[model samples]
Target: MMAAHGAPWFAGWGTLALVNAGLAQGKNRSGLGWFLLSLLLGPLATLLLVLLPKVRDRMF
Candidate 1:
């Protein structure tokens, strides 16, 4: 249902962040950064994922 509706903001974004954070770590660290960001950030993570870059570029 959510997959069909393009509501993958939760899974996909978390996965992407997790992978990126893991790659950023290079093999020593676990996915703590990923889990922390995804957990603490919550829906704000989604908002930040979508908006942070643009906000940084002053696209707002």
Candidate 2:
């Protein structure tokens, strides 16, 4: 088990990455790209993703 002091830090970042991935996908962006970016940029990436435009569905 991780140290008590380190548990929250790891869990918080992990969860943030997951949510970021989903947000990216929702925006029609690359989920994997956002997930990796979030691991480093954290909240900054989230803000950017939120400001990005959603992909429009092309129904031909």
Cα displacement (Å) at residue 12, model 1 = 1.7
Candidate 1 lDDT trough over 10 residues, lowest sum:
50-59
Per-residue lDDT of model 1, residues 1-60, tens digit only? 334555576677667666545543443333566457766665565454544332122255
Identify the candidate with maximal TM-score: 2
lDDT of each: 0.53, 0.92
Cα misplacement distance, residue 48 of candidate 2 (Å): 0.4
* Candidate 2: residue pairs that collide: none
The prediction achieving the highest lDDT against the true structure is: 2
After superposition, the stretches of candidate 2 with alpha carbons farther than 4 Å from their true spots are 57-60
Candidate 1 — which pairs collide?
none
Reference-based TM-score of each model: 0.34, 0.82
